[model samples]
Every structure is written in C-alpha cells, then in structure tokens.
Target: MMKSLLNAANFQLLWFACILGGDNWAVAAIVLYLIVHHYFFVESVSEWWVILLFVVLGVFIDGALIFDGWLVMPPSIWTFPIPPPWLLGLWAGVGSLFFHCLSWGLTRPWLLSIGAAVFAPLSYFLGADLAEVSLGRSSIATWALMAFIWFWLMQVGVFTTRLTIRRNGRTHHV
Candidate 1:
C-alpha cells in the first residue's frame, strides 16, 4: 500500500513538472527519467512496452485534438506541429500509472471507466489552469468530449493490460 501511494505521488509530481514546465529540455529529461524509473523500478520490460504503447496512443489522440483546435498550447522551446512534449510526457506518466498506482482498476473496467471519465477531464482542466493549455472557448463541451474519450480509453487500457499480463504468464489481478 505504501509503495502504491508513493508511486502515485511520484507520477503526479513528474506529470506536473512536465505540464507546468512547458516545452523545455527539462521536460525531455523528466520523461526520460519516467521511462527509466518505470523500466527499472516499476515493472518488467514487457510491461513497460505496453505502457509505452498507450503513451503513443495518447499522444496521437491528444495531438489530433490540438490540431483540430479543440485544445490549444502556447509556444514553447521544443515547438513542433503537434502538442508539446510535456503533454506527451504527461500522458506517459498517466499511462505508467495504469499498471502500478491504479492497478486495482485492472479488474474493474466499469469503475475504471467512471473514474477516468471524471478524473481525466479534471486533470486536463487542472493542467489548463496550471499551464498555458486550454479547452477552447467551449470548455464545457470540450470537457464532456474529454470525459467521453477517457471512458473508452480506460477500458482499452484495462483490456490491454489484462492481455499483456496474461500473455506474460502473470496473474491478471493487477
């Protein structure tokens, strides 16, 4: 229980640093640290690969939102044609949490979906407030869409985690 709480705390801190830091080299370092931390301390290499797949999926989905004007990011140091690296790093943190801090949700898809629907949008709103990201002028609609997206995404994560764990000859409880 203590380990779970500490992992969650680390995830939140790293995520905040990435999002609030904007597009900086430190964001890259933070992300690299997150990957290393996950690879060495959190889970096995196979689990890390699964986590990374979700991270990439998140990047593409969020990147689409940024491209479609549903979300906006301010100019940053590592500016590209998509959402900033910090946002991707934020996703990486959240993705990593799926297998560690929030592993209980792996056995409860409905609860995971509901939790994600609420917390995902709330986190995005918090990030918007903390950083230069926003959910556009129609914030409520955007928040609703975000909740909807996360509802399914959480289910997908649950299923993927189960499949990966089972394939690796591990108990699917976590």
Candidate 2:
C-alpha cells in the first residue's frame, strides 16, 4: 500500500512535469523515474516490454489523432508517425503505473476500463488546455472520442499484461 502511494505520487509529479515543462523536462522526468523504479521496484527485464508496448500503441493512437487534427501538437515533422515527445513520456509513465501503482487493476480489469472511459479522456482534455495543444474544433466531441479510444486501449492493456505475466511465470510487480 505504501509503495503504491509513492508510485502514484511519482506518476502525478511526472504528469505535471511533462505537461508544463514540455519535451525536455518530460524526458528528464521519465529517465529519473524509470531509473528509480527499475532499481527499487522492478524484478525482471520483462517490464521493459510493457513500456515498449505502450509506446507503440500510444504513438499509433495519438499519431492518428494528430494526423486527423483531433489533437494538434506543436508543429514538427514527427507529428504524424509519432506524437509529441512529452506525450510519449506521459504514456511511458502511464504504462509504468500498470505494474507498480495500479497493479490491482490487473485482477479487476473493469476498474481500469471504467477509469479509461471516465478519467483518461479528462487527462488529455486538461493536458491540452495546459500545454496549449488544441483539441480540434469541438472539445466535447474530441473528448468523447478519447473516452472511447481509451476504454478499448485498456482492453489491450489488460490482455498484454496478462499475457506477459503468464509467459514470464510471475505475478506483476507490486
């Protein structure tokens, strides 16, 4: 319980850093947090795979949104195939939470599903406002689409975690 609290705190700090500090700060925070997390909380290299999976999925999802103009990022050549650098860092943090702070959601996938539908979109909604990223024209419509996408993303998350854990022959960390 105490570990979870700390990890959650770390995640929240990462969120603020990524949203407010942009790409450079996001990279620094992600590196610091992952180093600490790996040294103390991680048991195996399999965890790296989790972060990788999230990165790929996150890029695809957010890239599509950006390409379609649902989410407008700062102009960059990397805008189509990859999302903003800070957002990539943010997704890595979220993936880390699955094994540390929010591992309980593995057993009860519904919690994460519900959270995806409810809180996940709100994060983007709020982050866009703070970071000056645009949510296209209609924030409400974009938010609704985000909600739907996140809910399904959780399905992939749950499946991936289960498959990875089962193959590795261990329960998740934390």
Candidate 3:
C-alpha cells in the first residue's frame, strides 16, 4: 500500500481528485504558489497546518452560511442530488489554503492588501460559480466591494501579527 501510494501516478491522481472535487481554481492558485515557493515537496509542518486550518475554517463558515440561507447549491449539480452540509466547509478550506499559500509570496503589506482586495472577490465568484450558486448579475460588484473591506481587515491582522513577531526579535521568512 505504501509503495503504491508513493507512486507518482497515484499522487497525481489524488491531486486530480481533489481538483475535481472542489474549487479547482483555488486549488490551482495554491499549486501555483507552491511551485513559485519551491516547496512542492510537501515536507513542511507549517504548510500542512495551514492547509488543515483553512479547510476547517472553510467548513465552519460554509456551515453558517448554509444555516443562515446566505448560500445554496442546487441539487442538479450533485450526483447525490442534495446539498451536503459539509460542502461549504470543504470549499472554504480549499479557498483558504489557496490564499494562505499565496500569502507566502506576498512580502509587503501593501502588496498583500491590494492583492487580497482584488483576488478575494474573484476567488469568491469563481468558487460560487463552480458550485453552481446563483447570485445574480450584481453579485460580482457587490462581492468585490465586500472583498475589499475583508481584505483590509486581513491586511491589518497579518501586519499586526508580523509586527508582533518582529518586535519579539524572532526571525522569519515569507
């Protein structure tokens, strides 16, 4: 089993399954980030935790959205013909993992802020579209504005965290 699992073909197939199962674009973004960072070996503890946390958070956020009726996926899209409660979280995990990976390449606070502002809405829209969620024509613009605000919050949080770490005289690489 271990030998088969270690096969390159098997690994590729597994990644392919993940891509087809959720937001492929977000996954692609993550893969791009990994490639850019030269950390594609999958050996980093921090990287693994980041991926796991993103997925968990996505699931929770999605669950709340479902509970509140803010989002819904039509039955036609699924082979099982019903929206699974865990789907939202799964999507969130995928997206968050992608964004967090991208964050590694972001060295400057302003660049991170702007990049998040632009990519957040695009990522949201792409995820929604992939999941077959209908948000009408104005959804893009509305979500873009919301994404910008959210990006600002994210920037502040990341900036503060980095500052705190720096103040403590800890050396880190981005």
Candidate 4:
C-alpha cells in the first residue's frame, strides 16, 4: 500500500519533469525513474512489453493528431511527425502505472473510463501549457479529442493488460 503511494508520487514527479523540464530536463529523470521502477516496483517481466505497447500507442495517437493538425509540439532535436522524446518518456511512465498506482482502477472499467476521460485530457492541457506547445487550432476541440481517445485507451488498455499480464507466476486478478 505504501509502495503504491510512493509510486504515485514518483509518477507525478515524472509528469512534472516531462512538462516543466521539457525534453532537456526529462532525460535524466526518465532514465532514473525507469530504473528505479523496474528495480523496485515492477510486478512482472511482462510489464515491460506493456510499456512498449503504450509507447507505440501513444506515439501513434500523438502522431495522428499532429498529422491531422489537432496537436502541435515545439521544435526539438527530434524532427517533425514523431513525438518528442520526452513525450515518449511520459508515455512509458504512464504504462508503468497500471502495475502500481493505477492498479485499483483496472478492475473498475466505468470508473477508469470516467477518470481517464477527465484527467488524461487535463494532463495534456497542463503539459501543453507548461511546455509552451500549441494545441492545434482549437484547444477545446483538441482537448475533447484527447478526452475521447484517453477514455477508450484506458478501457482497452486495462482489458488487454488484464488478459495478458501475470505477476509472480499468477494472473493479477485485481
């Protein structure tokens, strides 16, 4: 229980690091956070694949939004189309949440969907504002789109993770 709380705090720190630090500030934080997470909090080796899955999903969603002109990111060492690396770091951390801080929500689909719909878009808003990025031509529309995507993402993500994930040689029934 305590570890889950600590993990939640760690995730918040990473979120701030990604937003305030930008890609520049997030490099060390991402590396250190992932290392500590894998060492101390990971419940199963399969969780790494889940992280990869989210990386791809997040990149795809953000990339599609960029292509459709719904989201905009500032210039970075990385080029156009692909999301900035710091954003990828944030996605990885988000994936890691299911096994720890977000575990409680996985079992309650309606609650998870509602919370994700609300908070995920809010996070994007906060991240965009903090990072000084633009949300395409319309912030409201972009946020709504994000809300839709995140609502489905959490619902589907928990479904897939539940079907596949096993912790300590047994399925995580929670």
Candidate 3 TM-score to native: 0.49
Per-residue lDDT over 1-174 for candidate 4, one digit per residue giving the tens place of the 0 to 100 score: 888888889989988988888878888989998999999988678888888899899789888887787777787776756788788888888888887777787778779888999999899888888898888867778778888999898887787677656433555634
Q: Which ten residues in a row have the lowest lDDT in candidate 2?
A: 73-82
Clashes of each: 0, 0, 3, 0
Give TM-scores for every candidate, taking all chains together and pairing residue i with residue i.
0.90, 0.91, 0.49, 0.92
Question: By lDDT, highest first, what's the ranking?
Answer: 4, 2, 1, 3
Range of the 10 consecutive residues with the lowest summed lDDT in candidate 3: 1-10
Q: Model 1 Cα displacement at 61 (Å)?
A: 0.9
* TM-score leader: 4
> In candidate 4, which residue ranges exceed 4 Å CA deviation?
166-174
- Candidate 1 C-alpha lDDT tens digits along 15-109: 76776667665466566667666654565566777668777887789889988888877766655765677777767677677667678998788
- Model 3, 1-174: lDDT tens per residue? 333233333333333333345543435544553453335334334444444554555555544554455556555323542234334333333333322333452366676667667766675566567556655436756576547665764564455445544565654443
Deviation of model 2 at 48, angstroms? 1.0
The alpha-carbon lDDT assigned to residue 168 of candidate 4 equals 38
Better of 1 and 3 by lDDT: 1
Pick the winner on lDDT between candidates 1 and 2. Answer: 2
Query: What TM-score would you give candidate 1 relative to the actual structure?
Result: 0.90
Ranking by TM-score: 4, 2, 1, 3
- Stretches off by above 4 angstroms in model 3 are 1-39, 76-106, 136-174
User: Once superposed on the true structure, which residue ranges of model 1 sit more than 4 Å away at CA?
Assistant: 25-29, 172-174
